[model samples]
Target: MTPSVPSSSRRARRRTAAVGVLVAAAVTAAFALTLDDSAHRDDTPDPSAVVTGSAAPPPADDSLLALARRDPSDALAVGRADAPVVMIEYSDFQCPFCRQFAQNTEPELLRSYVDRGVLRIEWRNFPVFGEESEQAALAGWAAGQQGRFWEFHDVAYGEPRERNAGEFSEEKLTGMAREAGITDIGRFQADMASDKARSAVREDQEEGFRLGVTSTPAFLINGRPVLGAQPVATFTEAVETAAKAAKAAGR
Candidate 1:
């Protein structure tokens, strides 16, 4: 060598090279894991895809199941208070996926599970689309005050419309209420603008946000997360599984 390298210097160089290799290996492994996760997510069915059929397994966090407010008298809910399964729905009035569930899968659940006392349905207004969506949610709550919430819900989701269009204007909402058999339009209007209605909507929105619900038509069946407007079979299976589990747990 041109100059004799100190032994300490040689050892330091070796250590530095070893550390660099370890760092590179760690980074490459981390990247591989990230890519694997992304691939899995990409393979999963898109929630907004046309709901011909799909079923996602329950999420690990069971906190979502606690969303069900099982008050028998709750106007925004239906089915037995002690039903084996409670299905809580987070929905937007202007969401087309919500409409798809309402028009297609919901009726089947009503017939098989709700009517059979195997399931309960609780509705939460989660209007993420904007002003019209919020207005429609408030209108729905107002209709519930007059015992016409379901009727209003049917009218609102009975057909599809352009998002944020004039479909949910104040005048149109009143007409829908009338169609839903709400005789007292005056009281409905008053309730729609009341602090109570706003508070109720805010509470539901907070709950959705807390649970990280970023989309409409999200669901919790006995605390199991069933996202999107999945098919009727998906609901049936969820309901059946939940019912069995509830029975096993003596719930």
Candidate 2:
């Protein structure tokens, strides 16, 4: 017969196991940042197409995929609520690469996949710059309150602007609101300063941080992480492949 282990020894082993599990979880979440920092920059002009390759995305954590709300009434989102493929974008208005994606790639995805009801694009306000970035996020949400979020997005990203400058000041944001066709400037200012807007922006920022996203223009295509402002082909391939997989699995 074998000798029994001491109770104290068993307790220590259990504690070790618990710590190991937590460490593993943190590592898994942080792996993306390791790849992201080495491979991409926020303002790189001719950046690489995809960090993971043009091939099919690897299997992702289910919790990551569930981040997609797909609310049909989500003012900041565009495309079908039940689209098979959802591309969730975590971006900052002050980030040049984010602007590049917004101006160059997003429209193509809208025309090709979103219009066809094969993809949905969800915008997450992930402000990484500073106070100006946070205020801009709040401003975007305020525009959404008036059903002009995309219009505001277009105006904000219409041109490349310096980060942390006066580009996103309260007055500048108000001017952008008017440009985006917000009828009530008074209400827009009120909404932008409201607690609800701050909460909304905070919620989005927390989600990005939880995923270990350390930069602007990060994306999740059907739970698969796609870092940086990749080319339109990269987005196209991701969308199509995810669509096919969803169809095969009867999603």
Candidate 3:
């Protein structure tokens, strides 16, 4: 499945090529009377052709989070030792829809949960594409090394989809990291080549397969799974349920 288009790119920059015309006919030798007729032609394509497919069913996000914590070396989970709940997200950087989900739907989540320190968000890097994808995920994790993971992920996904070939070249990756406020660029580059970064990509892909997450932007809140670029309301409900469950378990 294609990544969700980011709200900014889709809503602001998309262009329409339709034309508008105005015509007038004059009648008279010295001073002619005028007739006015204006018409606009409609050629917009039907949305139903692409929009008719059955929506992919939503999965449980809580169970999925639990399933992801199996490997102690998972990239994002290592540092968040005291969080009440962990959030595991399977994401691709090139997906436009993933960009949309990050830019629009994720703000409220970050503000209330992550910023408040109630939930820890861990990024899992599963690159669906070839080199560009894998490289992008690695660079993103490298950005995380300098405390810029969220910034890099959010910004990269929103950038124009790169040329597929050579998209994740070292120059490109470092450039993107620099743009996302990652200082100490030398360390970031080294991290990209280390076993740490490559393992993150491979492990994410493996866990995704085991959990049937065959697509980008799959999410695991607590131990359950929610796939695709879902609405914000969906995530809110899942998080609330997870919090309640944790509370009940402690009791």
- Which candidate ranks first by lDDT, i.e. highest? 2
lDDT of 3 by residue, 227-247 (tens): 555667777887777777777
Each model's backbone clash number: 1, 0, 15
Q: Which candidate, 2 or 3, has the higher TM-score?
A: 2
- lDDT of each residue in 78-190, candidate 1, tens digit only: 89998989998989888877887898899999999899999999999999889999999999999999999999999998876677778899999999999999999999999
Q: Give each model's whole-structure lDDT.
A: 0.78, 0.82, 0.61
Residue pairs in clash, model 2? none
> Cα deviation in Å at residue 112, candidate 1?
0.3
In model 1, what are the clashing residue pairs, if there are any?
Answer: 65-223
Candidates ranked by lDDT, best first?
2, 1, 3
Per-model TM against the reference: 0.78, 0.82, 0.68
Native-to-model Cα distance after best TM-score fit, residue 221 in candidate 3, in Å: 1.4
